[model samples]
Target: MMREILYRLKDRYHFGTPTFQRDDLCFVTVKRDELRAILTELRDVEGFTHLTLLTAVDWLEERLFQLTYLINNREANLTLGLRVMLEREDEPGATTGDTIHDLWPTAATYQRELNEMFGINFPGSPRVDEEFILEGWTDLPPYRRDFDSLAYSQQTYNDLPGRKTHDPRDHMKKALYPTYLKEAE
Candidate 1:
């Protein structure tokens, strides 16, 4: 069953590689532009009706963000992973492909999360550009690979009162030295 879908995708689209991870799971890497058409075909024709998950991966070294759409064909008990890559910088750019919100309204939430967390835009998704989890966030997207979380936290949050900045290992060794000496004596 998975092989049939693989062959169908190969015949119709320019997919990179079709990998069967298991008896019921397959993955295919595709270009960003072809994402919508492929997803539409998968949903409408391939019996993959459930958009189980949508997420992003930061390929910091390659300066690319890979968006993964996991869809499930409930009838076949099979899952297909569709992946597309885009430039990581979100500088008022367009969506890589058509938003799948029409097929799965739940996609809006995932798209919104990716928009806020990784700064990936989903052009046709309603409220995708709007804030999803964060409120009044003025810094870089927190989930981006290049984001400096420690610096952001230090600048945004106040330090706890009487909290000393010391290495725990060193502090522990110092505190145990006298006890060791007493034991030896």
Candidate 2:
């Protein structure tokens, strides 16, 4: 079922082959400019009515952020992942894409979360500029792969007075194999 749809989209709009695929799932990587159009076609023509997931992954090494939209067809028992890549760095307008909230209202929340976490802009989403999970956050988006969790945690949280940090391996070796530690020393 997905194969036919992929072929049709490829013929019509020159969509590429699946980046990764399995028996019940297929992932197609599309250009940022083509995302909304392909998704609209999938929902309107392919009977993939359910937008199961919409999220972004930071590829810090590649300097790219990959946005994935997962859609499902219940009757066919199939799931399709539409992926698009965007620049990680903030350009003149920042890395933004069209809002699909109109197609799937729930996408508003997902877009908001992505905006809050990854700093990916969605120009038309009502809540995209608004805060989602994090309120009054002044730092970089917490979910970005480049976010320093240790630094943020240290800055945001106070250390408990009695808590002692220890190397887990050293503590485990001392406790579970005292004789081995003694012999090694």
lDDT tens string, model 1, 67-154?
8899999999999998888876645333353588988999999988988887778787998767669988877778888889999989
Could you give the C-alpha RMSD of every candidate to the true structure, in order shown?
4.6, 3.1
TM-score of each: 0.83, 0.85
Clashing pairs in 1: none
Per-residue alpha-carbon lDDT of candidate 2 for residues 1-185, written as tens digits (9 for 90 to 100): 77887888886575556765687798878887777788888888888899999998889899888888999988788899988888888432387867899999999999888888888888989867876788898888877887899998998999999999999998998899999889998
Instruction: List runs of model 2 lying over 4 Å from the truth.
Output: 19-21, 90-93, 168-185
lDDT of 2: 0.84
Among these predictions, the greatest lDDT belongs to 2
Off by over 4 Å in 1: 90-97, 164-185
Distance (Å) between predicted and true CA of 156, model 2? 2.6
Top-scoring candidate (TM-score): 2
